[model samples]
Target chain A: MAEECYTELEQAIQVLVANFYKYVSKHSLVRNKISKSSFRKMLQKELNHMLTDTGNRKAADKLIQNLDANHDGRISFDEYWTLIDCPYMVYPATDLCK
Target chain B: MAEECYTELEQAIQVLVANFYKYVSKHSLVRNKISKSSFRKMLQKELNHMLTDTGNRKAADKLIQNLDANHDGRISFDEYWTLIDCPYMVYPATDLCK
Candidate 1:
């Protein structure tokens, strides 16, 4: 599983998981989870190109609300993956497919 | 959203999505979905580095069973994302986190 040996697909999955950790709150009582504010920032910073409404507070908030399935007010890796699975986000980003 | 403008993380997300398409069966009655056989091939080819048990038919079947949430014969993009979200698959792949 060395970096040099990782397939393009494997490397891509790693980038996603690593990005989650990058935004996780170190001081939160619940570790390895992203805060609401940080999740918003992630959408704006990391997903701006795909999600056109990332810059819109209301749209972003609605997205976070939908993603936080457990009502935890935070985004876990699974919840984040749910966002990635969103067809609306991926289908419109034609450049990503190219 | 040009490839040149994609951030590292954005590019990573694209890879995951595109990989799914790569394995999708072109002749399947159900379009844009990976068949059981194709999914196994995907695991062995694209995810061998991250999933050690991809070579084992029983283990791979069990994993596929878990991923096929709706009990559909084919693996949709959402089902594929669920596989990616599995902690067991991602956590042990230390090189992926690096």
Candidate 2:
């Protein structure tokens, strides 16, 4: 349950992250340790324009529903984390691919 | 557990959203229904610069750990959502501030 949700958050963040790839990626505040190839790979998914695009946040809202998983009508930190923590695990894997 | 977690997500997002104040908020994709007054308030918190600043994402990493909350070492969507959902509840109240 948790893994599925964070997978979604990572999906959403990566989509939105494309928004600042050029600016934030080079800023050093976040780039010193993270590998560029992993960064690029994360940036590239669904990247015709925005892997992070909320093109129809209806999709986002629905995912929010999924994150809430238990049907509590509100998402708890645990549920939400499941949705967003995918990158922690994914980045290293993407690096291995490179 | 959930409320405490989303409280954190909201806290972190407001900080990050400040980064896009000049650009993303003005964009139609995300702003249509999310009230501007609430938006402004979100932009203002810890606003010397970045409410969203990862100035020391050590803070963020720590929070991520909190979202994971279960000592699971990996955050699930449930945990992540809790950290980021506070704004959804706070916005209507912030509009009342206006």
Highest-TM-score candidate: 1
Candidate 2 chain A minimal-lDDT segment of 10 residues: A89-98
What is candidate 1's CA lDDT for residue B6? 75
Docking class of 2: incorrect
Q: Write the per-residue lDDT of candidate 1 for residues A6-98, one digit (tens) a residue.
A: 889888888988999999989769798899889888887888777676777777778888889999999888888888877755775422222
Candidate 2 lDDT, B1-98, residue by residue in tens: 23243323332333333333332334365441223333234333422121243333354445445555566444333443453444422222222111
- How does the DockQ of candidate 1 come out? 0.73
Which window of 10 residues has the lowest lDDT sum in candidate 2 chain B? B89-98
Candidate 2 Cα misplacement greater than 4 A, ranges = A1-51, A87-98, B1-98
Candidate 2 contains a number of clashing pairs equal to 43
List, for all models, the DockQ compared with the true complex.
0.73, 0.02
Cα error, candidate 1, residue B97 (Å): 21
lDDT of 1: 0.80
User: Which stretch of 10 consecutive residues in model 1 chain A shows the poorest summed lDDT?
Assistant: A89-98
Reference-based TM-score, model 2:
0.22
How much TM-score does chain B earn in each model?
Answer: 0.87, 0.34
